[model samples]
Target: MAPLHSKSHTSLGSRKSSIFNFIQQPPQPDVYYVGVDVGTGSARACIIDTNGIILGLSERPITRHELKANFITQNSTEIWNAICYCVKNCIRESGVDPEDVFGIGFDATCSLVAINEKTDEPMAVGPDFTDHKENIILWMDHRSVDETIEINSSGDKSLKYVGGQMSIEMELPKMKWLKHNMPGGINSCKFYDLADFLTHKATGSEARSYCSTVCKQGLVPPGVDGSTTGWSKEFLLSLDLEELVEDDFRRLGGIPDKNGTFLSAGDIVGKLTAKSAEELGLSTECIVGSGVIDAYAGWIGTVAGKVDNPTVSNKLDSKNNGTILTSCGRLAAVAGTSTCHIAMTKEPCFVQGVWGPYKDVMAKDYWLAEGGQSCTGALLAHVLAIHPASNELSHLAEASNLSKFDYLNLILENLVVDNKSRSVVSLAKHMFFYGDFHGNRSPIADPKMRASIIGQSMDSSVNDLAIQYFGACEFIAQQTRQIVEEMEKGGHEIDCIFMSGGQCRNGLLMRLLADCTGLPIVIPRYIDAAVVFGSAILGAVAAEEAVQEHIHKKGKSRRSSILETQRSQTSLNKVGSGVQLGDGQHSPYTAPTATASTTNMATLAYASTQTGSHHQFPTMTPMTEETDYFNQPPQKKPFSDEDDSEDEQTLSFGSKSNVQKGLSQKLGNLSLKPLTKTTDTSPGAKLWKVMEKMTGPGKVILPSDENHPDRKLLNAKYKIFLEQCYKQQEYRDLVDGVEAENIKG
Candidate 1:
């Protein structure tokens, strides 16, 4: 019952400095941005200046109702109110004039929100359709499994973009579920992705973000799915959800003659409505930028972060014609309730069981592949909650003035020291956990997959709970490794992971992830608030565009026009002159010379090979290795080998075949080496300037030494991690086989 001790006890607190400390000193009269992020449990808002330093932040928790198992719903009205409260509080905290905040951006979960088109009031989507407040179908809700399966059975080509089938969580399936279950169907209602809904609430604009529609609503970007229109109308009709396609998909943000004006992330939606402005304690002059799904916001906030490590930065910085191409090697893993693994590629890489290969979702002219685990943080919480010793652990943690995770981590570290183990990885060497409790979202995209525990006992003690927690953390790391390998197979050569959200604070999870995957993890400066900062970045981009428009309309010099329009706004200070304006005129703002057209030839060649390919990749054969590990029982000292010399060994789990070798080789070839070119005075160049100034660097967690004994331990555990996945399938097959025989008899 003694207070546990570890070096990591103060690590999280020390790293989590106040955002105010990083704010620009002696606040200038510059335009500000309010970034609002509506997460699963809370609505958070932050105020950031032109330099992208967060000045103030506030958060308010929203209520969610789990009416039934896997039937989660929330009140849209409550969410909006929480957002408004957070925004107002953040503004008050920052002491910035409301008039000075020129732009606002919102990002939320990819949940579905329903409202009556006529009344503009919430409409219920839950079991009791009368209570209109419970209108939102949470992104994690799995009530539409049957509908999802039905839609997938149509064999629609649109399904290909969503990893061969639609998820139960997407809008279409939820819509279908609502259509079948709701009393009057969906004719009286309009649906919005949560992010789009927030923008609509703020600006009264029906504009949808490409980030929301392309990623969730199955709107394949134009030209990718061979459709002139973004929507697949034929696919909709096949599913008997033609109401969505009616009026040019009016309910889903499609305009009549104009089709739908799906703006890319950061595109200006409109100025805030008077009502919204008053409610949020802001001015109507605040332009609303198009919103992105929360994970994509994490991508925006983290991928462009400056790398402080020269060796890593030099390796990642492959610039062709002054364009920064470091994003290709960086995968943004936005880990919170669930973890979304997003990687950008020059061309669409169709990895089976991974969502996307969708264009223009997060960045311009780039394809994004999204893989995820449906539950990570939630899974860890579940593990703790269900265990018998959880209460004792909690009491001890509280007594020591530490969080449950910190307490558990301290216990783990102490165990390593006391047992003289190699590292924390060896703590759970006897116990392996497969955390697919909520379902697997990537590689093997099965929703029915259940969790497995290889070596659990009836030991109801706090020490047992800590080891279980360690195993759960190991599960998260191993799954990440699997997801990365799957992405690599699909043609992405990810060398580092840029992480955001609450999980970034978990030093144990971060270290495990790096060691498990053998990839350096870059932690953003804002940590928990990175997604909101990304939303703030959107606001900055929108503000820049809005300023340019004002200048062009006024027909005055750019600087004078901006100053007059913004009242006290100064010219962009970081990059001066040689920047392209919105109307093809040169501006005082400077940016990189890399134009969108200045792409690497090697990248182009790689895309050429995958031009018409579906989810096909080169056949990868298994690695040739001794089967001794699988043949023997689990070892207590997996790291204790006579060959444990400090010789560097690459800790790879899967095949070392030609395909694996080719992935690394192809990635190297695709490195965008610098090419000298004339300065690009294009409109896109100016946007790049905004991005460079706004995106800042953060603390970096390098992968554990490759020669460390823990590397071998993790590599071995990862194999057990993968084997358990197949073991679950084998168990399922056994049960299914007996059921089939019984039914036949």
Candidate 2:
């Protein structure tokens, strides 16, 4: 069906950019979503449009179940058959139109997954792997290190926004080490949160994701519109683990959707189940929605200021006084293969070791926090696969067709052009890189911190693996300038740095994170599989479904053609420069910039009221699924765990001023309370506390040369040798001579 302006696939890895293809038309009161995500390895899928663009994309990879230690696992029937093989190969490479898609969503990696509830089957999480299809558990499996040190020695005020400590990576110390080592492996069990098990595997509706139970199961706490969100039951009986609050919490999800919906992340949590529309070929009248926690869909892929339209993220909201954030607080990081960061505020500040201020999970009434880094792109492909010039730079990057990280960014741009150090992070002035091999997920939330490397040189050239890949991008931008100086000492006034996963295309780790955290990072315009277009903007704000109405040439609807495309605006060009997809596979699609560019408005006034940020794309016809307008009226699968558990399942939530606020004001004990000083702080936290205690130790702020005096003496000889190798016993004595990852019980 597509073939009007045909070609669309953009991705960016090899930079083939272009757009303007609306799959054989599509523009009227537009609608089209699809998202997907999955993560700890792969399973993407994009297919966007309502002006957040994208159109068609696909990804597949997946395979993990690696056992032995930091054990990982999977197989929710192989991640729902790799999300039905990347959504039928991204709707056959996005010729789109399975009834113009409408919705779908999903985001994963909070990884726990177990199920049964009378024969829904799959439970076994692990144990010499007996396979009820491994039944997940993954999110970096740290086998509940002594039940995360007995739930962080039972302090449990929800362990202070998870920064005060509780590491075996969330979900109640991996369900208390899976009920003390699988004691009868949970019978009619039910645990989910691999993005609410792909939205209860396409809506039989097990209902969770208030962004996967408020950020990785610290168990709900963020919804503040007149309170009452449940589960604390005395912090689950102070960790004796109250069978996860039996019936009421319905296996960790305080049950709401038996056709109710409003759980969040842009609503609409049901539909699609005609056996997930014949295993995702699509169309049981689509609309699944509700799912998150793949770094909150990479913080809904950087939603920019004053709701600068990623299809108007529901005017962000504080009841449209509109502050889904823009002037300050924008962090996001999203680095990929490990590296999180996030940050959003307006209320709860928290900090401690840095996890969250939580609530409204990713985007809404705000307060998210996050901070991570359990290995950046798996420690940059294990520092370029334990380099010995990585097999002759992978056969000279496949004989120069490029891509061994784009031929290691063209061997650090031919050893930094005319040379006088204009960047390869200033030729690793004495290599330091301490990438935390697979630990340190924030401030010092230490999961047994390991990994370091100080000045090595027996010259194993390829320019010493590009100065050890620019010393792992200047020690991950000095561990993001020490996690933005512990989130500006836990108050977060954080001015600039939005970045977005997959190492925001390195341009030397974005200029060594703007010269080691001197802020100014930006990079938005939703490019490449942007966490499946931020899970298809949570399935176009969870599609309203009624076949997203159209009919009336005058009967008027498509919500008045989306209020006449939001009171129209026009201009065109640049949407057609991105082709290359007959299918040699590589199109995560890019082009969504309908107006952003603002930098020097009087030295960083960054203004974006979005004036004529380009618009008007109305043209029509060509939407297919064997059209007769998709031959309506046959949807029967509106959720059926055996016919909606024989109907009448009683599920009502909120209002009449519903003010319960869970058992005794649910916050988990509460303590973390710093961040509120505001007299204009966070220029990357006063440039990372004046480069950590008054720039004396190996001084930095080295870029933006004051006429390069050998680039300010090689940035003061590696800023006094990385401030005399910042301590805590040299990376905790190299993580006690490391040996962790062998996790599952």
Candidate 3:
């Protein structure tokens, strides 16, 4: 909530300056929101205000087990415990009273997690079957490749809703693989999408978000006709998954919740499930929220309600017919180990070669169009690690108390000074990297595709590494550019880009993106915890369930209450000749002729005044120039016939009026201010060293070996942070030199 400003009363001079300043403050101090994100690697939580200010954040990595190639799984026990720990740590760091935390929300990857509710045990969805008790089908796992093709061959009616084909990465295929591979598994257990599982874990409710089911599971959302809703038993039967259809789609999930519909953020996700709370060292009072898919959360954070004070035209108000338009083909690229290019549309339109036109997956009213490569940030890391210059960079980074990345950035910056013609984006000229390291996720959707590199050399110098790394970035941007272009051809229009997650933080990456895409990228100044922020906002919304009714009653035409306060200089004086301050006549003087005065207060008034040409006041005024500030006509944009024609039409819409096009669904707001500043010493740097020492010399992932680059070079921040737990050590200190204390929950 922002401070209300009265547009009617504000003077022209002060209004512009005051509006930006006022919106910075939250409307209420006690209100708090939390967002939690579970990526492939870790679960993180962020505490924020209505104004998107992050108060606190924490993260913990969940344990994962990889039984064989293309078979990735995680223990539910580990993931749930990690979630609890992160939530508690966020609460403690925010220093907000539990009562102040109004709501919470969750977002996770579209991974598959299975549990046996009846037996209270885990069912294995693995190859060797050793870990039958704790099994999950990770999104990246390609074990269901055959099962996916089999399902796709059915050409079921539901296939029309998921852009005409299902893939191994989606839920249905994974579920089928689980049922077929482990015969007793489906009979004994319950299946949950990771997002829904987090929500169920939090709220003790089995409600599934529309975003999850439609995009990943191919659940046919209730068409405008409503009769078409629910899973197609006939379709499942065709795929030999009749058991799942016979279960009334129970195993596939049916209870649906809309995106941004809150459950609980810091409130009880059913009293922390007792046993779970104990493991996290938290009380049952610590509330949890229903979770969302990670990319969906990123979408939410990027395109939640519009900012009150926009520097340029409030695109939110101007675009797509002036209603709060659901994003029209907005591309939300969640760049990390891989990049997910997510888009949404009003009606179902299947584009060949893209992942989805999944209904109600990203937003309730619109369908989602997701596309991405198998590798982005991850490929960059691989290229850097194999470079010969990596060891020299690592040694410098260690001695200088900086991460190798930061140290490399410094070197790049120095190089730019000498060769002014070359930009960071241009460094990729002689190098190219393939994104299909794992496989092409979208456009091609080919799991068999392998990585291809062009223009490699025997020389792996610092310059070579820099050029190669920069090329990897350009490749990602080009990939996104390609995705957006393909989306437009498929009846969706992508106007602007909203990026988040790991890669968005890099200046080089962002600049390259803006240049390549030719669209203004609006990066929110929120915490990088988009997942948690989105969840927290939803949780806040859920806690205030009555708000819907209240808003309905208030009608949809509610303008944000803009409270404007006037602060003008008022002087009192005696107008008599030779009058002194002690004169009895105290006449309040109102300066009629606005002559430019020496006072700073008067200077502001003169500056806002315009000349006949309608140009803004020059930065410096010559003494000879007449200070005709007084009697200067009010400076306003000259009214034109075009303006009058546009102004005649009322643009008011309902509170939930669809307005801006190309906005992401409400995911989460991340508090990323801390990451923006350069630090003398980074926790990531220290952790790498410690891990290096722990592993000892001759290790492939060493800090000092340039030829044998450490695995941390993969992204701006290594994915290892998602799992690496830091223990308190004297050597580990904050960049500010503060002793590393125990991370508070």
Q: For each candidate in turn, give its C-alpha RMSD to the true structure in angstroms.
A: 16.7, 25.0, 21.9
Candidate 2 — worst ten consecutive residues by lDDT sum? 648-657
lDDT of each: 0.68, 0.54, 0.49
Q: What's the CA error at residue 726 for candidate 2, in Å?
A: 19
Candidate 1 segments exceeding 4 Å error: 1-28, 255-257, 319-325, 547-688
lDDT of 2 by residue, 534-586 (tens): 77767765663332353233325554454345336422111110112222221
**lDDT tens digits by residue: candidate 3, 405-473:** 434444555545456524333344445555455655666555555555667888767766766766666
lDDT of 1 by residue, 1-745 (tens): 0001111112333323422113222212345788998887678788875556566677767788897898999999999888888888777666576766768889998999999999989999977788889999998788998898899899977788888888887888999999888998888989999999999999888889888888888887777767767787888888888899898888888942286778877888998886888788876778888899988888888887665454566566654233434467689998776788988887789898899888877556677889999888778778888999988876776666544665676676566656866556776799989989977888899878989898998898987998998888889989999999989988999988988755554567777787889887776655566788889878877777555544345424354454466555432111101111233321100111100000111111111121221111222222112211011111121221112111101111111111011121011111121111225544334334555566655445567578877788889888888899988888998999999999999
Candidate 2 vs candidate 3: the TM-score winner is 3
Return the candidate ranking by TM-score, descending. 1, 3, 2
Per-candidate TM vs. native?
0.78, 0.32, 0.66
Which candidate achieves the best TM-score against the true structure? 1
* lDDT measured at residue 8 in model 1 versus the true structure, 0 to 100: 14
Descending-lDDT candidate ranking: 1, 2, 3
What count of clashes does model 2 give? 22
Better of 1 and 3 by TM-score: 1
